[model samples]
Target: MKGSQLGEENGRRSYESLRRTAQALETRADIARAALRLFRTRGWAGTTVRDVAREAGVSVPTVYSTYGNKQGLARALADAADLTAGVPRQLAELEAAAADPPRQLAAMAGYDRRLFERAGDVLRLLREAGRIEPELAAVYDDGRVRADETRARVFSSWPDGTLRPGLDLRAATDVYAALCTVDVYTTLTAERGWSPGRVERWWSDALARELLDR
Candidate 1:
């Protein structure tokens, strides 16, 4: 009977620990969703700890306890958002989609379109943070370089590749990313107010001529 009771106690302890962990994760998720909503609407400076606490349906002290401070809260919120977005999985999808150029570039275009459509919200959050939080940006998450390498491999072996002589796969891929970086889109569309059609035409021509065409 004593052994039975002890076993029961251990089982209960395990269940309790699991329950606590699940609750903590749920709370953090709530905080993250609330932060994004608030950040999108109120910008950075206008949003407060109290605002998150209210939206998250938690106490002000609880917010402090969970995230430590405003910046810490923002960092946690971003981390949580990344997790919810399944960005790592999306990145894997990106690599898999790279088998075809028109398709790979299209996949990239889809991702960038979603990113740009939410530019106001994203820019506001970034502006609030000023610089990327060091902890959030890690060397292990260098998927961009890996993706670039993959593109280089795919492009360098092209039948027409020899025409570019010393350009090489890696260099060509690097140039591809440089040309398609968000700054280019922001510059042409947001800064100069170029028509989307015009921008697309120019981009398509540039890619076909410089990369695809012999």
Candidate 2:
């Protein structure tokens, strides 16, 4: 009887441990998705811990206990997005292109056209959703900082067709970064009422005629 009781207790403990771990994972996942949706849609001013909790179907205190506050949630979103391999994914695509400059440029153009298309649209949509959510105010900006780092890598090439050529990558990166600002694009589109197709056309043409073409 004693042996059987001990075995049963051990099994119960094991099940509890596994359950706790599963719950933690699910909670973290929910927090991440909620942050993404909330931050992107509303900005920090519009989103609140309550909003995130509502979106995740958790509770206000749950988000607070998990992340400490809105800024913590923003950092969490940044770390989570970094884990998604987006920056590395682009680098891999660039590496796989042929050695020829023009061919490589063509490949990169195609790659980035697809990339920017989604990024632009998602950010724009996020602007709408985040407007009412206070917890997401800094989240989009934080993500942009990560993207700026990637853009800097893209501009390290010399005009002479050498890829990632310069000793100082930031110089090239800043110029390209300035041109690719989301705010500028948003102002052009929302304030000026430009269509996405037209903006994309300009993006493609700008890269082709100005930067990569040289």
Best by TM-score: 1
For model 2, state the Cα shift of residue 18 in Å.
15
Which tens-of-lDDT digit does each residue in 1-214 have in candidate 2? 6999999999999999999998986797788678767767886568787888899999888888888787677655654454343545556766774344444444444434444444554555444545765445556665667666655545543345553334245554454556555566677677899865666566555644544534
Assess each prediction's global lDDT (C-alpha) against the native: 0.62, 0.61
Model 1: residues with Cα > 4 Å off, grouped in runs: 1-29, 59-68, 76-89, 92-98, 124-177, 191-214
The TM-score measured for candidate 1 stands at: 0.53
Q: So what's the TM-score on candidate 2?
A: 0.52
lDDT of 1 by residue, 64-180 (tens): 888877766656545444554355554665678555555444444444444444443453345435556543242113334554765666565455544255676666676677776
